[model samples]
Target: MRFALNHIAAPNLSLPDFFTAAGELGVTAVEIRNDLPDVLSAWDPAQVKAEAEEAGVTIVSINALYPFNVWGGDLPARAEAMADYAAACGAKALVMCPLNDGTKVSFDSLVGALAAMKTILDTRGLTGLVEPLGFPISSLRTKAEAIRAIKAAGGEGTYRLMHDTFHHHLAGETEFFPDWTWLVHISGVTDPDVAVDAMLDAHRVLVDDADRLENVAQIRALLDAGYDGPFSFEPFASKVHDAADPKGALKTSMAFVSAQL
Candidate 1:
């Protein structure tokens, strides 16, 4: 299994440092975030691309365009700008997230949004990684639903799904689509009493032996089922940042995941 580093893993680290660490850890691919420090969001696109090239790292994907299904006045422009920036930053894909909160968006709306986004992505030779958030308030809650939307949008060749283990569990989705999946986000939740509806991204953490979410097993199953995409670490838990040695912790986690594979 190949490992890809997520920007959330070391949000405090500078872009150079993050890439350096990733390279040192034998990680060739990385996921950049619009919210992370010293990323394309803050730097010039040319410089960001140069820096990534100098660091010898390939950007796997952009973290996300949140509530992407809710296309409105500025949203279409913003999504287009983000897609351009992602392309300039040497990113292969843009992660598109679904709508959340109380607002109701029909599957038809999602299909429309995805079709529009696909046009933008295709123009720039980029792939759209459609991620279905499993939160109760989220409009898109399952990989199956995402697949359906992709088909409805006629995005079979332009878009791919992101199978996030945490969201998969929260959505209670048991189906897997290895062939259509572009990447897999791996993070475990340890809280036992946490309700699925209440599960937040902040609870994401490194996979541990006692993790209740079965992240390792799920990843193993994905691989066994013929998933050849990068398995990215996307822990949002604050403990990782507070650790005495975050890189050391990451190395340990990598070892654990390697053993599981």
Candidate 2:
């Protein structure tokens, strides 16, 4: 299944420890983050590469370039720097998330941003994994719109969609485009009391039978439809983050998902 671990799953771990944890869990690749471990603030790309290599794990990608839809001013510079770091760190891609603050962004703007970011990603030989946030306030909220923007931006080869199960359910999207999908972020929402619209990142957790997000169904659909890309765990709940034995917890969740699907 090529399961990959997201640093969000264990934000407390150091970058080196995160790599080692992934290796010990039998995962050969992992998605590192600039958000939590704050590698971008402290460590250089070369240092990150060395740590990953030492742990016998590969850095799948940097977690993101935020508000990538609103490209202007420092956005271009940030995109280029991130792409450069990703390239130097031996990471193959970058996750590009759109603005999610309730402000509406035009379709043309989305297209233009993708077009602009394309050059940066291309130059660094990195794929830009454009992830549509399903939040109501998110500027870009569906893979369909993202696919259209990619086509409009002439980004067929340079960009791919990130199919995040949590966001997918929130988006209430019915169609699946496995051909355009390169990475899948998985997290389950199990709270029975909260309405789907009320759900937040804090509700995201490891999948199980009690999961209300239909994670198994969604995953099976994607796999059956021919998505063979990496499935990365990205639980953001404090419960998951504070787990005493994260590796053990993740293994259990992985086994459950494996059995169900």
Each model's lDDT: 0.86, 0.91
What's the distance in Å from true for residue 34, model 1? 0.9
Encode model 2's per-residue lDDT on 41-116: one tens digit a residue. Answer: 7788899999988999878789889999998989898888888889989999999999999999999999999999
**Each candidate's clash count:** 0, 0
The deviation in Å at residue 237 for candidate 2 is 0.4
TM-score attained by model 2: 0.98
Judged by whole-model lDDT over C-alpha atoms, candidate 1 comes out at 0.86
For candidate 1, lDDT tens digit of each residue in 1-261?
999999888888878888888999888899998875437567777777887898899998987888889877788998988889988889999999887886789988898898888889999999999999898888899999888889998999999999999999999998889999989998888888887778898888888776777788888888889999998889888887566676787888889878876
lDDT of model 2 at residue 16?
87
Best by TM-score: 2
Looking at model 2, the pairs that clash are none
The true-versus-predicted C-alpha distance at residue 49 of model 2, in Å, is 0.4
Per-model TM values vs. the true structure: 0.96, 0.98
Runs with alpha carbons beyond 4 Å of true place in candidate 2: none
